[model samples]
Target chain A: AQSVAQPEDQVNVAEGNPLTVKCTYSVSGNPYLFWYVQYPNRGLQFLLKYITGDNLVKGSYGFEAEFNKSQTSFHLKKPSALVSDSALYFCAVNYGGSYIPTFGRGTSLIVHP
Target chain B: DTAVSQTPKYLVTQMGNDKSIKCEQNLGHDTMYWYKQDSKKFLKIMFSYNNKELIINETVPNRFSPKSPDKAHLNLHINSLELGDSAVYFCASSQAQTRNEQFFGPGTRLTVL
Candidate 1:
């Protein structure tokens, strides 16, 4: 079974400061990792995904994540945080054997101006 | 145009009642999935259909059934719902079974009293 973990339930950052939301996972085979963001009372929006190529993948809204094979970590990062960036972020993984994506408990990000 | 859409943004009913949530995607994707997000914001996949055929069915109980009448539409019907069934249900669609990036519809919040 594939499982993803987000250690922090919430993360707080100030505007103009860099922010990082950590995620880790375990899978039986090659893993497909993804990041998604959800606003209040809304559906999740796609952020980025890592399938096979580079370790760093850039996505919408100037966000990026780095996939570390040795550490089994895929952390979401942004150079600067904005108040509008506050939302619930989720990490998901799909084990190579199955196409179903398993999601982790989301992390609530709060950006202060 | 809306990529994915779900009806009855809010649903409240008694524990023993039956309810249905309809979903449609205009993205012309082949695979659609239903996922439940609990109060704690943990998301779990319940079912997935591809090309109007059942593809992935998780350990969900028999009371919850998903019907895909066509590729563009997938609806979920719950029978004999319980308090534990109260959660936010999101419908998402992707290009294919192997695609990880999914476009999600506004979730339907089901509150079973």
Candidate 2:
């Protein structure tokens, strides 16, 4: 079985400061990791994905994630946070020959002004 | 234009009642999925269809049935709604069953009283 985990239920960062939301995964085969963002009353939007790529992956809205194989982690990061960037973040993991992906319990990101 | 869209953005119904949520994608994707996001923000995949064929079916109850009339549409029908079923239901799609990033519809928030 494959699974993803967002250790933090919530993350708070001041505006203009860097923000990081941690994610880790467990899979039997090669992992295809993805990050998504969801605002209140909205569906999730794709942020980025790591599928046999460089360690660092850039995504929408000035966000990026580092895929660390040794740590089995894919942490979402933003160089500078904005109040408008506050939303719920989700990490999902899928493996080869699998049609289903397992999503982590979301992490609420609060960018305080 | 929205790449993916769902009908009935909000639904409030009594327990034991039946309801249906509709989803459509204009992205010309070949796969569609249904996911349930609980209040605690835990996301679980319920069903998946590829080109109108059922491909993935999770351990969901028999009361819940997903129908994909075509490659562009997937609708979920619940026979008996329960309070535990109250959650945000999301519909998503990917280019194929491969490791492509998914596009999600603006979720339908279902509340069973």
Candidate 3:
């Protein structure tokens, strides 16, 4: 069984500052990792994914995530934060041949302008 | 065009009433999924269907049943609605062999009183 853990319940950052949301996972085989964002009263939107190759993956709205295989972590990052960037973030993981991805409990990001 | 969409963005009903949420995807993806987001913003996968075939079925209650009429549509029906069932339900789709980044709908907020 695969599992995802987002240790933080909330993260606070100021506009123009770099932001990071931590995520870790446990899987039996090669893991497929992904990040998603959800605005208030909205569904999640895909941010980025790490299937193979480069450890660093860039995604929509200048968001990116780094897949650290040894650490079993995939952390989301952004060069600069904006007030509009505040939202709920989720981390999910799936292993080989598994159609189901286990999701984290989510971390709420608050970007103060 | 919306890549994924769900009907009845908000549902308010009393306990014991049955309801259903419908989802559709226009991205021609081969897989669809249903997820429940609880009050704490935790996302739990309820079911997944690939090519209209049942693929992933989580430990969801028996009252919750998912049906896929086709590869593009997946509907969730909840019987014996309970207050514990009140949560935001999301529908997502992805192509299995592709990058597998899920596209999500706006979500349906179900409220049982």
Candidate 4:
């Protein structure tokens, strides 16, 4: 069985500061990881995914995630934060063979202006 | 156009009642999935269908059923609804071969009283 873990329930950052939302996964073989963001009462929007290429994956809204095979982590990062960037973020993982993707408990990002 | 869509953005019903949420995807994807997001923002996959065939069925209660009439449509039906079933249900679709990125529909919020 595949699983994902998000250690933080919420992450706070100030505007113009860097932010990181942590995520880790346990899966057999290689994994396909994804990040999604959801605003209040809205559906999730895809941010980015790591399949098999470079460890650094860039995504929408200037967001990026670093895939660390050794750490079993895919942490979403942004060089700078904005109040509008505050939202619920989810990390998902799926082994290459399965059609099902397991999502982590979301991390609420709160950016103070 | 909405790549994925769900009907009845919000549903409020009494316990023991039966309700259904309909989902559709216009992305021409081969796979569709149903996920439940609890108050804590933990997401769990309930069911998945590929080409109208059940592919992934999680350990969900027997009262919760999913039907996929075609490749583009997947509906969730809950019988004898309970308070514990109150949550947001999301429908998503992705191409089966790659299955890297999934497009999500605005979730259906089910509130059982």
| DockQ metric, candidate 4 | 0.70
Candidate 4: CAPRI quality band: medium
Model 4 regions more than 4 Å off: none
Cα lDDT tens digits, model 1, B11-87, are 99998999999999999888899999999888888887886457656579988888988899999999999999999
Best by DockQ: 2
TM-score of chain A of each: 0.98, 0.98, 0.98, 0.98
lDDT at position A90, candidate 2: 94
Model 3, span A1-113: residue lDDT tens: 88999999999999999999999999988999999999998889889999999999999999999999999999999999999999999999988768888889999999998
For model 4, state the Cα shift of residue A4 in Å. Answer: 1.5
At residue A88, what lDDT does model 2 achieve?
95
lDDT string for model 2 (A1-113, tens) is 79888999999999999999999999989999999999998889999999985999999999999999999999999999999999999999999868888889999999999
Poorly placed runs, candidate 3 (over 4 Å): B56-58
Candidate 1 residue B17 Cα shift, in angstroms, is 1.2
True contacts kept of each: 0.67, 0.79, 0.70, 0.63
What is candidate 2's CAPRI-style docking category based on DockQ?
A: medium
Tens-digit per-residue lDDT, A7-83, candidate 1: 99999999999999999999988888999999999999999999989999999999999999999999999999999
Instruction: Output the worst ten-in-a-row residue range by lDDT, candidate 2 chain B.
Output: B50-59
Better of 2 and 3 by DockQ: 2
TM-score of each: 0.95, 0.95, 0.95, 0.96
Q: Once superposed on the true structure, which residue ranges of model 2 sit more than 4 Å away at CA? A: none
